[model samples]
Target: MHRTASIGLAAACLAAAGVAQTASATAPETPATYLERIAAIDDAGPAIHAVVAIAPDPAGGAQGGAQGGAQGGGPLAGRAVLVKDNIETRDMPTTAGSLALKDNATGRDAPLVARLRAAGAVILGKTNLSEWANFRGDRSSSGWSAVGGQTRNPHALDRSPCGSSSGSGAAVAAGMAWAAIGTETDGSITCPASVAGVVGFKPTVGLVSRTYIVPISASQDTAGPMTTSVADAAMLLTAMAGTDPADPATAEAGRHAVDFAAALSGASLRGVRVGVLRGQAGTTPALTAVFDKALADMKAAGAEIVDVAFKPEARMGEAEYAVLLHEFRKGIDAYLAGLPGQPPARDLAGLIAFNKAHADAELRWYGQEIFEQALAATDEAVYRKARQDARRLAGTEGIDALLARHEVDVLVAPTTSPAWPIDPLLGDHFLDIGAGSLAAIAGYPHLTVPMGAAEGLPVGLSFIAGRWDDAKVLRVGAAYETVRSARLAPPSLRRWGE
Candidate 1:
């Protein structure tokens, strides 16, 4: 039977038990209700295309149902949560926005998804993403996927939603879910959340398990929370974080996974040291003004601001790119090989072949040069060197050094410029840069909170700190969020130049 039909009576029962309480209504909104709401926004009304698949059962599905759902217990009780399509779910196919994986449903929840369910969160569905987490091709649109088409910016239909967590960000911004999970290898999570006017938190690499998510760069990839507020991000992160033996990087996660929401209770900017990364803030005059106003707000909140500067080596980007190529080849190969049954594409080469075979749909907009490059990158020695350079430059000599030199508790910058127009013919035009690269490569905690809107486009203020300081970063973000004056109005869905 369909989940909504089967669960209707049980949902009514749960509603009476206070499992479905919502801020907007006294009437209990069950997981099925959330699904219906999301479908209207994603498929019917605005046609945001944020959601790719809905779970027949949130507790568990074809993989074998778990007795967990809105009834699992805790802060997320009855909360409907969406995850990036790259993250596996028991009922929904984890397509990573690729048509090749449309039928590749593994019938297993990713460890992180299981954790969320265990915390009373109902796994609403999988959100669309940039295909292959935005690593499949060159000149590709940020939110387009062969499986789900394009996810338009909720702010402005003509604008880009960024990527590869584009749908996750957009879903939360549009209030389709209480919160969503997004994976970032670089700017995937923060960029989309910023552009979509939501809060996104990219925890330190080892702070969250990455098992069962689609691969890009093992060294850089991580799943995190995308929500409309920092407190919601904290609540989601609290459930999502834990040590997974299968993911060796998360060996220390158990140690860092404390009560993140608890930290927010004491969040205060008073007497806190804040480092302003003026150089990283883009030169867009309106965005710069928004950032300046944010800095002033921090001061009014009692934060002591100190200007800090750090320049990355020109080779850092090149080295990071090389490392990603090497790791994508090995990591994706292993992930595909481990799948339970025969899949259309078992490795990078197979994926490339599959795309070419279905080029009419997959390659209609762009070419998969990144896939080709990753498949051909067989030089382990060069990969090792590049990895070393990237880590040192981004970590030791970059974020870490800058923090120590400036004696600041945390660093802040404008996350990115306002959303740009989506151009299928030309691809992403990043009018300005952000602070995502340094923290992404360094495996540090990064948080982006909506700062303000510029020309009807939302931008965010980024908070980045040293590794394992996830709680601290959230606290600081929350502190700023509480005091910020700018509020994002609902998306206008306006045409370009409107």
Candidate 2:
């Protein structure tokens, strides 16, 4: 069967099943009704576990109310947005995909949520995420957690939706929301987006505030957009940027916030310099072909393409892992201390004990060895050294040095290989030659846009720009997406039984 035909057949079968399940399925719901319908569908069919909680009344006063001029009339007015559970919202509990903070609710919104409200977006609900943003355990399933169950990939019902922002990626791809917010410590955002066939943008560390958000590593964590298009991602970023009193890092963000939409001139790619990282090769032939087409597209669009050889940073993953473990222990403790009521699990030791008490609920698939490792560490000096080493190798000696040598505006590579078949028993068997390692460890910005499909699965082309040059990455991604004309469509399956 032709790939498009296969997609159509899958969608038709699913839609038929959906129609049979619901009596009122004659037409797609309006924005208000659509939100409710999708939320119901998510819970019943596909069983995607994409949503952590749905607002009983998403169109209530907190979400701008019914009289709020069609949800504020902003650029994304009338659009439904799914927020990753880790990003705090006063209306719902921010669990960070862990049972530890499942019942804790703060009556204040994260600064970014408030910004989204100001821009007129209808705050749909919270999406599931990897427990503690996947920092809790070694061998953790990327999209499984005690609080929200497991988020399934929309493309393949059984595949992992690589996290820690799994829900955001799946929700957007499944049409549960027009767009969603996803945070990254490393490959969390891009990984899921790549696998789910959506756009994921990891902004420079300070571009979005981390205050009121559940933190893993304050130095590396920043909230960005997970959307179906580069244009939608850019729109969300505009609303998310600005200095906030709660987060000091964002104090420098004002200078970086520009009208990214205006930068989307169809002719912007003309005279642009793009560096293709030749060393990185995807896992499959289909993915490589998709990437080759993307490179050709960029060249045909008048961008200068330079193929550059770059080696994988030695020991970078170990060093970055060390930093995350150390930070997770310290950051969670501090956040718990500031909470108003008794926290579900007060500290790292308390959390470990709680998980032991409820193994079925917490440790069904993975052990908390990562948390144990973080807890076992006693030396602060070693932790600081590991962080510094990671920065040196990934930043000064890796991405920055390579870019300087090539004199390129941005580096491009396959965001990930083709989507792996979904497996519940063994968890994610990802085979992608990832482009995130450099940007992640170096604390640089990375953006991925859907280039085309590999087999029936989608492939993303990554744009890795200079530090604090998120705008440049967004500009180029937007331009390429416009020319490529790839649109994200939801999966054909409506439920597991189907």
Most TM-score-accurate candidate: 1
For candidate 1, the lDDT comes to: 0.83
For residues 260-320, what per-residue lDDT tens digits would candidate 2 score against the true structure?
6566555367788898986686547787788888888888888899988887755777888
Number of the top lDDT candidate: 1
Worst 10 residues of 1 by lDDT: 16-25
Off by over 4 Å in 1: 1-29, 57-72, 496-498
Pairs with backbone N, CA or C atoms under 3 Å apart (clashes), candidate 2: 46-494, 46-495, 158-422, 159-422
Summed over model 2, clashes come to 4
Candidate 2: lDDT over CA atoms?
A: 0.76
Superposed on all Cα atoms, the candidates' RMSDs to the truth, in angstroms, are 5.0, 5.9
